[model samples]
Target: MEVKRMTDREIVFRLLRYEQANLRNYQNYLAYTKNKDLSAYIARTIPQIEGNIKSLNVLSRKLCGG
Candidate 1:
């Protein structure tokens, strides 16, 4: 199989999609879990996830010239 190059916009889109999926997974973990310690661990990681999203947004805007 041949690999194709992605444009900047496509890269940004994929990055944003990945970030969204991670956040969604964390949300689901929080929703269905009964373990307090695990929930606390997830809560602690929320800030890191938010930071990643912010960084990706900045990179996307820079790439798109928005």
Candidate 2:
């Protein structure tokens, strides 16, 4: 089996997709969790994920020319 390398754009796309997926999961968990502590934890974690997504989105836009 041979490994394939990804270009910078491909890597950025994958990272953005993964971060979006995590954001969705955290949103769902925060919305549906019955335990208050768990919900709070999810809420706390979500902002970091959101910040990463925002940064990646900016990078993607920069790569794509605004």
Best by TM-score: 2
TM-score: model 1 vs. ground truth: 0.82
Q: After the best TM-score superposition of candidate 1, give how far the Cα of residue 56 lies from its true spot, in angstroms.
A: 0.6
Q: Tell me how many clashing residue pairs each candidate has.
A: 0, 0
- Under the 3 Å rule for N, CA and C atoms, how many clashes does model 2 have? 0
Q: Candidate 1, residues 1-66: lDDT per residue as tens digits?
A: 999999988987898899889999998998989999999999988778888999999998888888
Candidate 2 per-residue lDDT over residues 1-66, each given as its tens digit: 999988777888899999999999999888888999998899899999999999999998888878
lDDT of 1 at 24: 91
Which residue pairs in model 1 clash with each other?
none
